[model samples]
Target: MNHRPAEARQSPARTTEVGVRYAIVPVPVLSLETVARRTGLHPDLIRRFVALGLVDAGRDTSGRPVFAPTAPAALARVQRLRTGLCLNYASIGLVLDLLDRISLLEAALRRAGMRSDLPPWT
Candidate 1:
């Protein structure tokens, strides 16, 4: 019982004047206080994450740090590593070092014309 129409079997896309745009990325913009509220961390510690260049936060017109939606997940990971593993800030440095290696691997792959659908942390 194959009753699907030909158009229905076609690739799903919004028919706009600019053709097809397949990527649907979620960009959540959050303030520092909002990130602290979401991650249950102190504002100062969130600032430290920004200072360490761990989270991808950017500025609004007012020039305040606005975190992405992924920031909460990243902060949760860092918090878990710090609390559960009893990792000091210095050990956090080591964790970031390993992550940087992974980043280098991904960059090399990209430079070699390979692709990765996963994030660096994943």
Candidate 2:
């Protein structure tokens, strides 16, 4: 599953250009191993994120997992949510579920010119 974020897929030349000003740097790609190293997590835990549908994988025909450049940072957040917040895996599942629902709602809210401070927002 070699998926890319919308902006990256849209522009191959520059990630995002500010008209004539400059281009926003696109994040780099990270393999699962690197993600583990960067996140200080066991490789098994990284795989669990994929199984848990927490992080999306990059484009790859092989079964190996490749992560987006931003994934290490994102996984770090999940790590905090687990360790710092003391949430168990089951709790994590529920929280993730709520977050997904909130994301869907937020898109609708944005289209309606309204916003709320909520889940996966920060």
Best candidate, lDDT = 1
The residue pairs in collision within model 1 are none
CA RMSD per model (angstroms) = 14.1, 8.4
Q: How do the residues 69-95 of candidate 1 rate in per-residue lDDT, one tens digit apiece?
A: 667887787787788889886676568
C-alpha-based local distance difference test score of model 2: 0.67
Q: Report the number of clashing residue pairs per model.
A: 0, 2
> Candidate 2: which stretches are off by over 4 Å?
1-28, 115-122
Q: Write the per-residue lDDT of candidate 2 for residues 3-115, one digit (tens) a residue.
A: 22424432245324655523355546678888888888899988887777666665546767777777876677667779888997667666766766788788998897765
Q: Which parts of model 1 are misplaced by more than 4 Å?
A: 1-26, 97-122
